[model samples]
Target: MNNYLTPNFAFANMIPVHAQGSRVWDQAGKEYVDFSGGIAVNALGHCHPVLVDTLTDQAKKLWHASNIYTTEPAQQLAKLLVDHTFADKVFFANSGAEANEAAFKLARKYAYEHYGAQKNEIIACVNGFHGRTLFTVSVGGQSKYQEGFAPLPEGISHIPYNNIEALKNTINERTCAVVLELVQGESGVLPAQVEFVQAARQLCDQYQSLLVFDEVQTGMGRTGKLFAYEHYGVSPDILSSAKALGAGFPIGAMLTTDKVAPSFGVGSHGSTFGGNPLACAVGCAAFNIINDQKTYENINKQSQALINELNVIGQSTGLFKEVRGKGLLVGCVLTDQYTNQAGEITKIALEQGLMLLQAGGSVLRFAPSLLLTDEDRQEGIKRFEQACQNFLSHY
Candidate 1:
């Protein structure tokens, strides 16, 4: 069973054979309730009917015509995104990293054209996770990711997250853009304060720097809104989206207003497999289903239910310090007694037929499907409690 593959990922021993709704079965037929949702990519759950049908239908008609020609599905998907969000235009890519790369480039380009090269500096928050590309990794605030990647892209500076004074002190006339995630997903599901977000917008406006929101994890209804910025009542000049956009099909989009869209002129930026028909077709279906009032209501409802259950488990077991997040994107911080053991907890959860994720080494991350059912929630919670109890007993 030695298949040729890169060893980049620390893969689990269990091999998943199939999945339906919120449940997955391994090769040996052990069932596990999904609580990760493919790291927030599977918004509608595994093999959703609408998305599957859309992908299938588009697969028959067209697959890849490249960027030389635009397809109907791409056009429709772009329109849907534009109509729902603050964006006036859209640029498609294949993953969150590409979308973020496009965003970083667009920010620099906009600054360079409107101002000059000296204005190319981009300021991002510390501990923020953008993407894995060299430019994005550099723009990201974590030093661990940027180690040995020099001479990295220049003019990128980092400031403490949610610190308005630090942001104010750092951002100035030469700043090109200030990029941040509404909720820092990889850094323990820390949501940006509303006032802090407002200050960033105001400062960016004052300094004439563009405001960019990396919504790769918080977009497409993950944070109980169509976009997390909507909750803050502030809009970004540029925004990146990918996870859950196609309901598991690979797709990424960088959206912007008309003012900033012209900066990325023809021949300035492009992608070969971006905006393909197959991906856009599924994206269209997913958008239509997610952008409904009922869907938003359901997300808020289920988010509260899940949070309540996690709190109960925490109080009963005394393993959790805090549970914080918006909507379906939840994080449970381990108490000091159980610090830096999030990975160990997930490993034990796996053995108890539960799938989970850890944000760094201290917080348990839960990004479940928006349409998670009561039955799945109950079953998952049961397994999670058992796993937590087992972990406590062992450790």
Candidate 2:
């Protein structure tokens, strides 16, 4: 029983009162290890001292000086992102959707201004999730997200994900941009085959179209690499990033090369609250930590350990069809025998004092904080095994 006015979000009955590191306390004071990591947004974990110090310090000085005349924090963050990645320019926004929206718009604008309006077609892969905005939903692959929103944006087509032939048949010179997620996080934890990505890059190059990578979930060290594109050795002309950018402080950014950036000149695109001082301050702190080489080594070590443990669990109980994914963003793909049991598994995990997520009906998702400790990981595994055992005893 709650008093909030939301018919959209299916609110959980258990309300979290506080969190620290990779753990949360519910209203009843029950402790649960947060394997969800705020759906992969708490990159450095809850209340990392650096983020806390930065946000608090910025809050005391300035919180909301709009994008007109950028602040020092925003400048510092932009410089850091440009220095570390392939981006030559950056645009800040409030969420992943906004960042992606800007990326699409910028691509079309660049194609139109340089090429022509006839080149405005955009191609996205089937089963990929972008964001919830109308334009993004139209560009996104899932039909369910576009069901009620008809008269959707035209000139966008969906092709089978990771199918190079389908991409080859669909993409052409008319295409302005080909958008993709290196790892499909919503439909299931499916990674883009390296060959497919390389083919897409080649196709885009041949057609003179920009390649867009939606790294909203895969960026900021979720994939053991700072950005998933780094894993493939292919670079996108335009990129959208979020989730872990602010380390739970709520921020998103669209990055682009210098050639495509001018398309968003004065009055082209703007956000009132975007590039605000507070969010940028937090983002700067997060960027420094996640972009460090030491962070990647730590992520790789933890990721290997978790992958090994999950495989052992899968083999012993035969509950998981496969354990797949990279770094902290992992998924346990259920076999046909347990295709519809993801919900049950999640409920059981929660009761056992662990939080988990599901990519689809059958994939149990795990996106723990990058800073999740060895102790916490072992405790989470034990609890997870107990939950599976309880379910098996009844089944």
TM-scores for all candidates?
A: 0.99, 0.98
Alpha carbon lDDT at 303, candidate 2: 91
Name the best candidate (by TM-score): 1
Q: Model-by-model lDDT, in order?
A: 0.94, 0.92
RMSD after CA superposition, every candidate: 0.8, 1.0
Instruction: Please give the lDDT score at residue 194 for candidate 2.
Output: 96
Best-fitting candidate, scored by lDDT: 1
What digit string (tens of lDDT, one per residue) describes model 1 on residues 165-270?
9998999899999999999999899999999999999999999999999999999999999999999999999999999998899999999999999999989999
**Model 2 RMSD, rounded to 1 decimal:** 1.0
